[model samples]
Target: MPVRTADAALAGVRRGVGAERLTGRTALVTGSSRGMGRAAAIRLAQEGALVAVHYNRDEAAAREVVTSVEKDGGRAFAVRGELGVDGDVDGLFAVLEEDLRERTGSTDLHILVNNAGVMGGVGADEVTPEQFDRIFAVNAKAPFFLIQRALRNMPDGGRIINISSGLTRFANPDEIAYAMSKGALEQLALHFAKALGPRRITINSVAPGITRNGNPVFDIPEVVEQMAGLSAFGRVGEPEDVADVVAFLATDEARWITGSFVDATGGTLLG
Candidate 1:
């Protein structure tokens, strides 16, 4: 069955659901200048949450997202910081704090979406120490520390959503390092879920399949067709496809779901 829109499903919720479902809520989405991060940030703002759009080096793209969010009657701001640096995580949160205070009069962060990642194409034999370190630094280390920082401002019922890749399950030889990093993130999700369970905070990972988000991986027509065929749905995944799942997980509707890896991979792993 298809899910109904807020307007069609619950008239009462649409009529007077004060931003509590997301109104006063604040969210931080890293790598949100484009792709999955951009989609997720916009979706969160549409649902009433104030958004903090974080980008690594794309100031213009980040600002564009913030502008789009604001144009839609949502509140958003952009922050720049490299993931995995010692003070970078702190700087990102510091900006988040400032944005939250300016928008909601509080520094309380309610949602943290660790969506920044890099794919390493090095095979096992070609994988360099630097390549491995770089992938893990962004995919694993940055998210772990960001979670630690998010927890300080996140009270009970806070949400932490991590983005992983379906490569972790298929384990392609070319993306060993990237897969490994994502696999570690899945494990981190489980651990954080257990650690934060007592406080009612939810931590989960969303693994995407071969999503054609203007990434170089899908540049070749043959490769794109192969990826489309890999999914049981017979199509490549879209950013909005994954964004919808992320938005669902952020809602009160997903209160019972946590410590889990929800495969938003369009049935790519089924075959």
Candidate 2:
């Protein structure tokens, strides 16, 4: 089986997530310049939320996302700050709050999607202390702090979604450190859902497996087939697949659900 190109895979799969269920709401998706983050940003905007497209260094790509959202008749803006660095969250929120206050006359954020992460530190033997620290810093610490700051302005009944990975549930020795980092990320949802319950804020983690994100290896038929077979659906996961889940979590439909690990993995490795 040939690997499905991104265009082909998304051709029919892309559509509006809701009929303005999130109208008048504001969302911030981190690392949204490309991949799942880009897709999630677009999906949230489609639901009528004013989106904040956050990027680390790709200002051009981030601008494109803002343009895409605008072209779709939705409102969006781009914010830049490199995660895992000192003052990253503060710097990001500065620009974000400025935009929010200017646009809506308020700094209230309704949804926060912690989608930014690093994916190195391969295995135990190959992993170095530097890599482990960086991985945890980006994947775990950054989101932890971002949530800490977001809650201040996030109103009651807000939604917080952390983009996690299937490696947290399934074993992947090759990604030991990365998996550990994501595992720590999952704990954020579990713990915060309880702590923030009084405020009616719901926090959850969405785990995706072997998602295609424009990687060159996915262009190879053999590699695609091998990965596709791992999923119960007999196809590789697409960004839209997980983005839909993220959008749902942000909606009122998922209000009863919190402190959950949602499997957006195309049923990967389910015998």
Candidate 3:
């Protein structure tokens, strides 16, 4: 009966103060200015996480996300850093630490979601070395270093969730670099899970297929219909769809699962 914003979805958590699932935890979500990252950050906030919404260029959008979370009766702050650039990971942490110490009185972190990335649609024959380098820098290298740096501040039972893609399993030559980066992310999770298992920290990847990530195709009726037909549900996946999966992975209920590539593709890989 009403149009629901991301903040509206989080109102359920406001039924009672301190009734949320992650009341004392802190989460940092990269590229949270829009799309799946935005939804994931908001949902985590709904569960009572003090979310650090990170963005590169769109400071306005990042502030919007923080506002949305705050409006939902949750806590969030915006952090900025250009990913894929040198010192990006450390730069992000520096700003975040200052904010945390000022606001929460501590720089400790519990959850790290690597969601900022670049998508390349260049085919092998046409892709240049520069494009390949940029894609890997943003999609793979950034996450790797981010996790490496986060482990220091992260305590036991922390969660590291990397946003991957179902493209790794499907053959899409136009996006080969993007797919390869996701594969590398899965492998990173596989190894990191073991490395952090002693601390009870879990690392995993959530791979989604063809979700509305600022893609104009979803706006065109004919194109949307064709893409929806690809899924068993006969509908396109939304940002919230993958956000829910990422949120689950960050929760204690998903403690048993680690080093796994979860298919959040809406059964896109089923058939």
Q: Top model by TM-score, which number?
A: 2
Give the TM-scores of the predictions, in the order they appear: 0.90, 0.95, 0.93
Candidates sorted on lDDT, descending: 2, 3, 1
What is the Cα-based TM-score of model 3? 0.93
Point out the higher-scoring one by TM-score: 1 or 3. 3
Candidate 2 C-alpha lDDT tens digits along 1-271: 4545344546865477448889999999999999999999999999999999999889999999999999889899999889998998899899999999999999999999999988883667889889999999999999999999999999999999999999998988888899999999999999999999999999999999999887898888888888988888778888888998999999999999999999988888998
The per-prediction tally of clashing pairs is 1, 0, 0
lDDT of 2: 0.92
Off by over 4 Å in 3: 1-19
Model 1 over residues 21-51: C-alpha lDDT tens digits? 6777889999999999998998898888888
Off by over 4 Å in 1: 1-20, 216-222
Alpha-carbon deviation at 159 in model 2, angstroms: 0.4
lDDT of each: 0.85, 0.92, 0.87
Ranking by TM-score: 2, 3, 1
Q: Model 2, 79: alpha-carbon shift in Å? A: 0.2
Runs in model 2 lying further than 4 Å from the true structure? 1-10
- lDDT of candidate 3 over 1-271, digit per residue (tens): 2222223444444332354778889999999999999989988998889999999889999999999889878999999999998989899999998988887899989999999989887888898989999999999999999999998899899999999998988889899988998899889889998888999999999998878878777778778777777776666787888888888889899999999989888778577
